[model samples]
Target: QSEDDVKTHKGEDQSEDHIGACRGENNFERIPVAVSCAEKPYKCSECSYSSKSSSYMKLHLLTHSDNRPYKCSECSYSCKSSGNLNKHMSTHSDEKPYKCSECNYTCKWPGVLKKHEVIHSFDKPYECYVCNYKCKTSSCLKTHIRIHTGERPFKCSECNFSCVTSGNLKIHLRSHTGEKPYKCSECNYSARTSGELTRHKVTHSLDRPYKCSECNYSCKLARDLNCHLRIHTGEKPYKCRECNYCCTQSGHLIRHMRMHTGEKPFKCVECNFSTSQSGDLKRHMKIHTGEKPYKCSECDYSCIKAGTLLRHMKTHWRKAKLI
Candidate 1:
């Protein structure tokens, strides 16, 4: 063959090799191949694909399968391929492999680090085709689109509740079951949701992470902080239709409605007695069970009812001369 023809044949072979590599063949060793920046690329063997570097070829392969062969030596972390492993190593090295052109914040992974820098740059690259809402990531934009479409794919088998995402559905399930798997070791408090448990745990740690933007009142959770902010703003959005009673929380409004409707949802199996609230039913149950769950922290005084315990605490205060 002619020399030029031979070179053309070699280029074709390289193109085929790249395509095979992209299709998930571990053909190339870690050896680097140098090519001129201006040279036209060749197509892949298995598909119509071309890449400037062999590393790009390997990354493209990971998209086809769920294989994570590369692992982190420092931790039990693994990735679908070697390129991801290289990215994961940067985290342990404290290396900012990815940088934002607009901001100074650096990240270990190029994708995540790129996202962080977008906040400082105010760059909304991913725009929702349905709405004007813009997001930094395509995934966020896709999720937002569901709101417009009213597409709730995630559904709770136990209830009629449906959510746009699986994560939201999982959170909704806690409300029905009242299954609080997470508990605080320091306190008797527990919560059905992890977010609530996390907030409860913060109370033990004395970590008021949520600070009011308007005032000095801080709370362990963002919801508590929001409610506290309403106190400063004098915002009572929840109003009772039956009475002139106004509340800051929707839950308070719901309980107030029960008083007007004479609706006792909580009932005792042992007796025909019913109460408007679950807490009231629980306190009443103590009359039958003779369980004194509430006790005075100061003295040996204890009572089945929390109100009685409060009155008992006052007696202790009176004895201590504090009140």
Candidate 2:
């Protein structure tokens, strides 16, 4: 009787082990085949779409919806991912953690710093298939592609100005708004843009980097040299559509156009007197304010305009008071 009881317990243990092994095999077969096959290519668990590269999957996730989970504390900036938001925060802090391996150029963002390093290394992996043009950045190559297509995606809302990039359109909008955000720390003068402010600062430094090929005349600003070159070339780029009046400078052309249109934008702030030109209005305002900006180099004589001072200097050249 004891031997029969021991034999029955052993038989039950063997049956349990066989059932457990079968259950394990069934679970292994029930596992999703797509998940196992997707091990080679990354698949977004949230969406079933699989991508060959992980970076493409990340970029594709942004297109699903307006999922801007990352927020910036310094400004009203947001991004779809935490990594992008972290990169943007560096701009506000002015912290450049990324340094170029080849040069002294540093950038707040790693992507920009990598692009700068390519310049020193002269590594242009991105190339145009249509042309001989090549660029270190894929973004730059995409922009160059627009040159072949003649695509001007950015357009000014205020005017007919159009550009290939949104950045150029932003600069063009300053002309309409006259918004000068760039100011000189040394002086009270400001400019519409940083580039203009930089050029204005060069005047204070008296750094005449641009020189004329024809004469010894030099100017700190490139625009001044371009205008000076016009003198040698006699190239009149500005022309009056109303009349045959032509001028080298756009301001002079604008003033000439006023003669035909009888349009005077400048008016005296004190009196109701107005003039067609700003210089005329400035001279007229001196009558009310009694401000003389021009001084005679010869004598203590002062005048409102340089032309008036020049006329006053003529008296010194002539004999004493006329009989």
Q: lDDT (0-100) at residue 227 of candidate 2?
A: 89
Model 2 poorest 10 in a row by lDDT? 26-35
lDDT of 1 by residue, 33-149 (tens): 344776424334456566666567656555555676787776666668666577546644534567777767565566676556656756789876643456787777776666545
Candidate 2 per-residue lDDT, tens place, 79-129, comes to: 688777876566445356788876676766676667666666578898877
Candidate 2 error regions (>4 Å): 1-180, 186-188, 192-196, 295-301, 320-323
Error of 1 at 160 (Å): 15
Span of ten consecutive residues with least summed lDDT in model 1: 26-35
TM-score of candidate 2 on Cα atoms, chains taken together: 0.43
User: Which clashing pairs does model 2 show?
Assistant: none
| Backbone clashes, candidate 2 | 0
**Clash count of each predicted structure:** 2, 0
